[model samples]
Target: MSETELPPEPALDAGELDADDRLKPEFVRSVLDAVEEGDTEAAKARVEPLHPADIADLIELTPADLRPALAAALSDRLDGDVLAEMNDWVREELLAALEPHQVADLAAELDTDDAVAIIETLEEEDQRAVLRALDPDDRAAIEEALSYPEESAGRLMQRELIAVPEHWTVGDVIDYLRSDEELSTDFWEIFVVDPAHRPVGTCHLSWLLRTPRVVQVTDVMRREQTLIPVDMDQEEVALRFQKYALISAAVIDAGGRLVGMITVDDVVHIISEEAGEDALLLSGAGDGDINEPVRDSYRSRVRWLVANLFTALVASFIIAQFGAAIEQMVALAVLMPIVASIGGNAGTQTMAIAVRALATNQLTQSNTLRTVRREIVVALLNGATIAVLLGIGAALVFANPQLGVVIAAAMVINVLVAGLAGVLVPVTLERLGQDPAVASSVFVTMVTDSMGFFAFLGLAVASGLVG
Candidate 1:
């Protein structure tokens, strides 16, 4: 089936496991029931209704304490596609729970990339045992993939791909495809390669099937194809796929010989990961997978909160500067928080947009100034709209029109500063070769909160509205 047409899997029912979500709770209960009964037939029946992805999600969602029972129930039915969909943490746990030979048996059913992903999570000793359990050829392929750097194209690309000699006629290609016992499953295109086994061009399966049998493979092939280097980072590989709108691209080695192929399907996973990773990094929440252990979750999130505490202290220090003003005029204390809160929210909004744009390459040095100007303009309009409403409210509440004017002016200043800081901080951080998403929020919040307090309270004191 086409990627878009792939059936929905619904047995996982993990976090956000509302009844209406794709993976319903009822299905999860059914799977557990079957596992408890030690009925592999019933377990497969329960899962047979779900998609491979959903089956994978179900495996991941099964409580760690209950996984061995579930795995034993599923038996050989726990296939490659299901393994591919499992979260890393859960996958590792499951692999450890199984014997090395059992893990190797299941992994061997997968494509080389999926197989590598599964085996890589095993303990080093377990990994060695699993590798030894596989057939020599399959073991060699997995070892070759493990040799590559983590998250590189070599580790992710499928080793199976169809390639043909440029000299072959359609008739020859047709007969070969029909008779060859060893063609890769689910290929989109047939690559045309030179004698050195380097791809020169590619022919879409649609074109291959429609052409006259007498036509040479080269006659119908498109020579201008995206060639992926095995060593390219997965992020760069995803960028190339997005930029070129590629469905599949051939992976070549140092000698420019076809080694494997990377598909849009794999790119989909990379895009999801990179996007989710940045979101988690921005919030100082590492990984953010629900299956992650509690200690790990706390360890990742607390450091960021500690950093936020230091930044919050800096904002508080600014507030201390206007202590006399706040003491003399209670209005200063009430109004100060309003300014900081508004500016903090505004800065967060702008920062989120900038970070996303940077990830998508929609915001870059070329349009950095333009983006900054646009956000500043946005802040000005937002400030004016909010200030008018707030100023009028403050005037009536405090029974002092002058106090309203002080706050309104401060509001405008703080918000405009927020917009500028929001864009500039992340952009500057990125330029300095740091991940803008990783620590940008803390810095932007510090600027907005400190400036908001200083502008509002300091102005009230300077305006003689307070002793």
Candidate 2:
């Protein structure tokens, strides 16, 4: 059907596309049914009016085994924007089904960063075939982007940005933007560059529109601008964008020449991706995507489970050392888990805050000691509050005030230990050039568990509560 002949999309409610929104089950089922019935035209019509992101979601929501069939049903309706919006694994699966030249065609229609994302997923031989099929300029851009480290600014910034000589007038800039059909259509700002192609300033589109025609671009441009280094990590790039409230920024090479530009749209993706990634890493849940293959998920998770098992053994061994004390006073066994549970919870809380702070560059060498001291104070306050409640309850229930005092003291000790372990584990991992999020929880839990058992049981024995 022709574009004009197609039905208009239904108006969506305000929350229709909220961040947490998912495609309706009915809608997903309807589309899948059409695909299953071999009604390609019906499937295409059902999806045609959806946003690219929603289209991507529909694809993801479909069963993975059925996805290739869905893609085939959609056929020509699947485009680069939808592919770009797709989950990485879903996109990889779809891309694998396409021939190299067909993949090249899709890449040709995307910006350099996205095109690189698609191409880099292909095997080396397939990547070569796709590259050979692309236009020379597109091929060169993708090749250069691929050469950069993954998740770096070079691989994230788009090559198609508006950069003009610093001497151009507002009228000239406007005219050039209007006439350059090949230029990127979605830029918010124009970069002012020197003769040697170094970006010197940036002019927002709004500023250009408000200025007189004859005014020089430099006169209207802001000379001070944040420039991203090509090799900068994508997380750092997101941080810079956030810190400066930047809408767009020029990317520079080793020689400080403008190579490309990164827009806030791209940074939005990076920020979300990084935040989710850190959270997943903290749990040792690799990728944590529901659509991840079972074998892949099991492989990633079992290794961490094994490590946790060993850590649990360390806590078990501590309990063994106090087996005699536990036998004499069964109450010690009953109250032991309460101490460890609270301490473990406290440690997890502190670890989460530390990981988030480290991820956002909030916790640094300069403020590390201050953050640590603050957590220690907070831990003491929490420990005191819980200790009083538990102490009174234990004294009343067990009819032994001395037992209450010993347990209270152990509570304070374990909680303080938990606070220290939480901060120290992540900070130490970071110093060793490892991800602070990945294994910090395991180590912190180990410390809290082992120390909680040791402190509680040792004090019980020392206080003569046990034979």
Candidate 3:
């Protein structure tokens, strides 16, 4: 369907497209127009109707210098969610630009995870100031959450939860929930806990409402709860949520006391973060936030590019050794790249699979040898197919049977080596306490390139096909 024919965009207002609903392109044009006309009131009017998240996105989309002006235009509407949704580095700069009272006000409205996320973005002194400005209770809760290791479940979980002792009846649960002045604003399940406050079980809201009020909590609650430990990594939490098909899970502290809770909504964010983080890290790009400052982006990306250059020099050094060989036969120069390209592509395919398997803990020592063998087999079959096609092409192109056979043999050997290096290098790196994903790609590429050149050139030299 055409863009206009598509269902009305949600970002737009009901029955009409408002300035707040304008996406980046439209928003940018409108803001630029306002700036050109020196229309501050017009800009404010255009920005005022956006949701906090939308406003945050709009601010982020604005050029860096214009952020302060945008912030001024939006003023008090820049709430907690907007701050939370802002990229960390951008949030850091923006929080610095905001007053302490403004930062604290936004923090107070956010859930514990989002509040901590924004607070942690501040400079150390600013973090202290923002914390100090918060109410004592909010400050204490946020501080306690910050005490957990960063990116752990404790830090990510919400402090708010619905929990009751196992001895309580369904009626008691209903009454406590109804009468208690303090309860989480959002909860999908009620945790049944021990006297020690350790989660023993959980009951979905549906189960609680449908079961007779007279039923014991134990009778109604499901015993098989996936209680997440506070120290668990957020990625693991997401995995558990996915594996158990859970809507929410209770979180426990070091002593196994119920401390907080995590929901699918939080898990969704964690999953996205972890997945994107791995992708960026694999490319040696730090954070990869679009809103990241240009300098920060350059710093994060250049080191890897430099490292790649050094490695490319190493590959070039290898190629230089065959200068005489290439000079003797122009066909060798033409065909060498073919061999390297094929091997590099093959290695990358396997490296990606291995890295993903390692991340998921599916490629452990128990199955490593088996997986390696299977990959080698697959590589051999693939190599045979490609080599045959290339062999015929080489024979037709160069009109040399020996050259065709030589390239064909080199292709097969290099591809097999490529496949083995793909699995072995990554698995070994992971075992040696290195991140398999980040370093594996570079090493795999190096191996395939070097091996491809060496095998093809070495074979030709051995056969005395070139001198």
Candidate 4:
């Protein structure tokens, strides 16, 4: 930001962070230098001006060994907001370094959802310790959130929200809001509730400020609003927020009573996380966070690699069935790999698109066939282009017209099968209640590789090229 555009008293220095919001290297170096020099106050002064997110980033950027010293030097700045903004792995490590009471104090300062995130990952004993340290009200809220399944809307929503009865006028709301010292200050809207505390409407703060004091709360509130079930998946919650263009929505219990609220900021995090997760799952990299521990990264990736090995064996077994043809015609061995390679690439291209479409809810029951048909047409065009090029080149190099025609036919057949497998594998897995991104690559790769070799060799023999 330019000097003039900056706030009169900015918490964040405009020049300290790069375009990507990362702390500048020089700033990091200066802070670390002060910390190492035992000038704790200087280090704090340098970091104290940064935003909570930037403090989190600074801690993350610090070396593992030095993080303790840095955290100590700036312990006062490492508040709940900074912890909430930190990476999961990093925050877990930092929280581990603190006492249960200290962690409880930090958790108590946060909204119910963020507090739950920090506490839910603790060991059972540690969780109890933290819970015991928390105030009863805070403990109860966190305990209730913990009862929900991991990654459910209940775990994502915060208990802190603004809810006023519909019978109240704007004057009453203004008075109540002003009279109540403990109400959350972060709410964007005042949710209008029924006698039973179920959300009936939502009134943005702007509506309250603009309306006359005599206006009934129901008169200005928007009646149509999305209500999220507490048990809904976080991913589905994100989709709902996106579909409705919501800034915030009330989360309801099974009885349709208002329980908590999910804000757009929470959905943004879920969107980024799920998008990255789906991409990693497609590649079988499993929780592909660089901050992940080495053993965890190894364990997650190795299982998939093992599955891939078995899938490779299936393709190898297919290749063995055509050994006689390969022995008779050395040309078959020379060109078989090319066919498989092309088919595998083709399948991956379609699979990525299909998985993303499925994730974003763009590809649904109504459009499945249409999507398949479109991919088939694309596959045909792609296959024909590659086949013609390979065929012409093979005819010239091998000096065999029959061989070129055989491989060309095989190329077209394999690519077509590849496209079908790419879409069908994920879709079928989704239908069977499996994660398409998780298992689709293995099945799709196996289908493409096996079908490629089988088609090329089978077509060559059928064309009498081997004879």
Candidate 5:
């Protein structure tokens, strides 16, 4: 079947799918029932109508033990597009079961970027085997892409794009597009290149369709275009696409020659992947994909927990310094956690905002001071609001007015400190060339917890409430 046409899908009842059009429990079970029964035709018929993305989702949603059997049952129906859409862990597992030559064939069917994504996931020896199995041209292209830094424009861009010489008239451009069967079937705009193969301008298909046939391509082309550096980071590329509202941008080599093109579709994936990746990193949760292996998940998460354990000790040590005071007044011990909890939560809120701003280029060197000042004001307001509520509650609950004043003062101090740590930790990490998302949370949590305990307990002792 062609890319657009698949075998007709079996008729599904309205209740067979979820509100989001995802395969519902009953539908998935039905497909699994077919596969379990060794009914290949039934399985194919059931999955035929689903989009490639949905098919990928089905593969992931299936039980891991049954995945291989399901894949075997629907082997002929699975394609590169479906593979591209599958979760990396799920796709990797499936690919591991395929022969090198079979893997190469699947990669050949995908766009270069998607193909690279598949190939890059293979073990080194397996990657070599797959590369050897590929055709020479395909091998060369994938090899070049692999050589580039991972997540760079070279790795994300597609080799296939329409680039016409600037000298071509509207008629000539139209004729070439019509006559060239190998040209990419999907594109919004045609790039106009110089004699040196450097991109000079771009002409939208809509513009070409409306313009007079005699008009020169250069005359009709937009000279101002967002040209992406081939070595630019994928996150930065996504930012440029978002900032400029670009549908597609040309990727150029160090010599300023057009190498490939990154469409908004590719940028969309990058944005999503990066966003999820940062979120996972912030929590030290690793990939956080449901399909992630238990072992991998354990390894990614345990180290963070260990670090948090050490940081927790810092707070414990602070509390120990006020041990006498805490023993004298039980209320101090009881109220300390409330202060720490609120402060940690506040810090997390600020850290999330700072990390996102850094990732999206919303917070930069030019605006860093402004952003920091804005966060401080927000933190102060948040601290005061929480302090008043908590202080009143403490006074009423414990019937200790002196304790209320001490706790209130401590709340404001710790919250302000938490806010500073939140913004500063991420910003400093970024400046030092570290990922703000990865280690910022760890440090921020440590700061908030330690300072919250110190501020609260220390204030109670100093105010004679604990003495």
Candidate 6:
């Protein structure tokens, strides 16, 4: 190479990652540059030192056109761990490019849950092919996992837990653990099961160490344990973990037999995903991931926009009815938007609180009335404060006390109606077996906008400010 054609930049060292442990922009660009230049060795070497998640990040950061090449360059290092860390959309793309046997190999290296996560997203025919390629044992495990509904405990649990018979002595448990090289090493607690394979108690490692070797495991194990049903929604699983401060819990089937286990680490990922999912769903944005496909993003978002369009027409229809009143006093038109906009914001704030409360199980049938009452009182206080301030300003600016009273009264009515709708819409949807977050915003926005326009204009005519 000529002197003017400078040597390629070297790989980033350990210090190059930012404080959040995210790979730096320059580092990512350098690796991508190496791949683009066809210097596969340089690209591989640059990524070799990074963690699996970081490697996943590097692939995600690579442009879509370059992803396959980058992935190919790092194929030796790309295994179950990196795949597990990848964004779901990106992983699906990479997995699609791989042969069924290749996917089986990756799935074999993962625990049951991670393996299921990787495999479940495959097409039905591809899923069957991958299953055929898997070992008999792995195939059975994955098949059972796939049988459960998506996002249930069965789909999220790993079958690699250590479960000891209830009759085993501490010494017996120790001997089996020592001798059984096939047993999983990642567990923090061991489940003690009865003859029927039903979990009776849980034994922490510390307890086993402190107890006498001759003592029965059941004697030392904690009898009070939270058992998660196989069909339990993952959100409820997260709530269980949070409420009980659980390190690990047994996942049981309909027969009350321990089928697998879920640890805190798995629940942590679920918690983040659920929280973000609910937030996005509330905004009518489906699966708001940056790596989401353009078509998918468009499809999910446009439907909501269409829904909003219909909702907006309802408000428009209200405004059209009062066109004469608005035209009679131009100030009415100028001030009307303030009522709607402020009411909308107020509704959003209350709806957020209600949704969060419901998500966390803090708002339930036992206390729904209390929550409603509390929000109503809060809305009144907010409405009154804003109304007083707005009233004075409208009075001074418009030089009409009656106009000020009209707008101020309309603001209170709209905001109060907004707050009421915010809570009621979500609760009502939830009761009707719909996801509150997914439909709440549209309904709440409709209520606020319609009431804002209707209240302001209707009150104006009654107050003799116009029309």
Best by lDDT: 6
Model 4 lDDT-worst window of ten: 2-11
The parts of candidate 6 lying over 4 Å away from their true place are 1-22
C-alpha positional error of residue 274 in candidate 3 after TM-score superposition, expressed in Å:
1.6
Question: What TM-score would every model get versus the actual structure?
Answer: 0.91, 0.95, 0.92, 0.94, 0.95, 0.96
> 2 or 3: which has the higher TM-score?
2
lDDT of 5 by residue, 1-467 (tens): 53322234454542455546658766777787777677778778878777888889888888888899989988887889999999999999999999999999999998899999999999999999999999998899999999999999999999989999988899999999999898889899999999999999999999999999999999999999999999999999999999999999999999999999999999999999999999999999988988888999999999999999999899999998999988888888899899999999999999999999999988899998988888889989999999999999999999988888888988998899989999999999999999999998889999999999999888877777756
lDDT of each: 0.86, 0.89, 0.84, 0.90, 0.90, 0.91
Which pairs clash inside model 3?
A: none
List, residue by residue over 333-433, the lDDT tens digit for candidate 1: 88888999999999989988999888778889999999988998999999998888888889999999988888998899889999998899889998999
Deviation in Å, model 4, residue 246 alpha carbon? 0.5
Which portions of model 2 show Cα errors greater than 4 Å? 1-22
By TM-score, who's the top model here?
6
lDDT of 3: 0.84
- Which structure is stronger by TM-score: 3 or 6? 6
| Candidates arranged by TM-score, highest first | 6, 5, 2, 4, 3, 1
Worst 10 residues of 3 by lDDT: 3-12
lDDT of 6 by residue, 88-139 (tens): 9999999999999999999999999999999999999999999999999999
Under the 3 Å rule for N, CA and C atoms, how many clashes does model 3 have? Answer: 0
Q: Please give me the total number of clashing residue pairs in predicted model 4.
A: 0
Model 2: lDDT to the true structure: 0.89
Candidate 4 positional error at 22, Å: 6.4
